[model samples]
Target chain A: MSTKNSEAGEGKERAGDVIVETVARLMVPFIQLFALYVIIHGAGGPGGGFQGGVIFGASFVLLVIAFGIVNAGDRFPEGANTAFMSLGVYIYAGVGLLCIIFSLGAAQFLNYGFIPLTTHFEENRALGMDLVEIGIGITVMAVVTSIFFNLAWKREPEEGGEEE
Target chain B: MIPSLDLVLLFLIVAIAIAAITVRDLLSAIMLLCAYSFLMAVIWVEMHAVDVAFTEAAVGAGASTAFLIAALSRTTRWEKK
Candidate 1:
C-alpha cells in the first residue's frame, strides 16, 4: 500500500510541475495588475490595504514556484528586498506623522479633518483613507513577499548533508 | 443557512481539509491545504467579509502553497507513520 501511495505521489508531483509552469506564466502579469487595481479601487469597494498587499505578494511567490527559488532571489536580491520593506514602512508611518503635524484639534491620529487639506470633510476623509490604505498595502506586500522568499530559499551544505 | 449551495461548499471545505491532513505524502498534503484555503476563502466571501476573503485567497491559497511546495522540494516527502 505504501509503495502504491509513493507512486501516486510521484505522478501527482509530475502533474503539478507542469501545471505550476503554465499557471505561473499566465498569472504573473495578471496578478500584478489586479493587485494594483485593488489598491486603487479599494477606496470605493470591498477591497483594501491587506487584500491588495497579499495579492502583490502572491505574484512573487508564484514566480518562485514556477521557476526556482534561486531565480526569484536573483531577480529580487537581498538588498532590494530590504529597501522595499523599509520603504513601505516609512510610507505608512510617514502618513500618520504628516497628519499630526498638519492637523490640529483632530480626534486622533489618521484623522483627515485635522490636515485641513480640503474644505469638504468627506473629500479630506477620502484622501486620508486612500493614503493610509496605500501605506498598508505597500508594507503588507513587501513584508509578506520577503517572508515567502526567506522560506522558499534553502542553501545546501558543502559536506553533502542538509544544512540545519 | 439552509441553501443547497452553501451546504455543498461547506462539504467541499470539510473534504479538502480532511484530505490535507490525512495525506501521507507531504507534497500532496500541501497541495490539498491550498485547496482547503481556497474553499475557506469562498466561505469568507459567502459570509460577506470580502476583504478577508481576498486576503485568504491570495496569501493562504497562493503564497502559502508556493512556500510550502518550495520548502518541500528541499526535504523528504514521506513521513514515518
Candidate 2:
C-alpha cells in the first residue's frame, strides 16, 4: 500500500513539472509578438529600438530559465544567433551606406531624406525609422541571449581548487 | 487625472526598484526585479506608450523573470549578507 501511494505522489510531482514546462513554452510566441509590437509602434509610443530589442532578447532568456539552458540552446543554435546579430547590424548600416552611394548628402549617415522612400521625404523618414527599430530589436535579442548562454555555461571553479 | 496616475506609477516603479536592489536573498531580489519591471510598464502606459508597456509586461515580467530564476537555480539561492 505504501509503495502504491509513493508511486502516485511521484506521478503528481512529474505532472506538475510538465505543467510548468508547458506553460513556459507557450509564453515564447506571445513574448516575441509583443516585442515586435513595441518596435514597430515605438515612433508613436514610449518605446524605441533599444527597449524593444532588449524585450525580444528577454524571451529567449526566459526560455533558457524556464526550460533548461541546454534545451534553449538546442532551439537557438550558436550559428543562428550570430547570423541574426550580423544581419541586424548589416541592415542598419546598409541603409546608411545606401544614402552615401546615392550622393544625397554626405553630412548625415542615417538621414532618411537622402534615400527617398516613394519619392517623399516623410515616407522615407518613416521607413528609415521602422527599419532602424527592426535592426535594433534583432541585434539586442541575439546579443542578450548570447550573453545569458555564455554566463550560464561557464564552468564553476571546483571547491578549494588552486587559483590559476 | 492622467498626471496623477503617472505620479502613482512612478512611485511604484521607484519602490520596486529599491526593493529589488536592497533584497538580500537572490531569489527575492529577482522576483522584486520582476515587480519593478511591471511597475515600469505601468509608467510606460501612462506616458501614452501602449506598445512599450505591452513589451515590458511580456518580456520583463515574463521572460526576464524566468531567466533570473533559471540562473538562480544553477547557483546558491541565499547570501551571507
TM values, all candidates: 0.80, 0.71
Tens digits of per-residue lDDT for model 2, B2-72: 87887878888788888878878999999888888888877887787776677788678866776676577
Candidate 2 has a TM-score of 0.71
TM-score of chain B of 1: 0.87
lDDT of 2 by residue, A1-164 (tens): 33432332321222336776788789889977877887898877667776778877887776665655544566888899899999999989988787777655565788866776778887887888888888888888888788777656433355226534
lDDT, candidate 2, at A7 = 37
i-RMS for every candidate (Å) is 3.9, 5.6
Candidate 2 has an lDDT of: 0.74
Candidate whose DockQ is highest: 1
For candidate 1, lDDT tens digit of each residue in A37-89?
89888989968888888888888776765665554567888778778777777
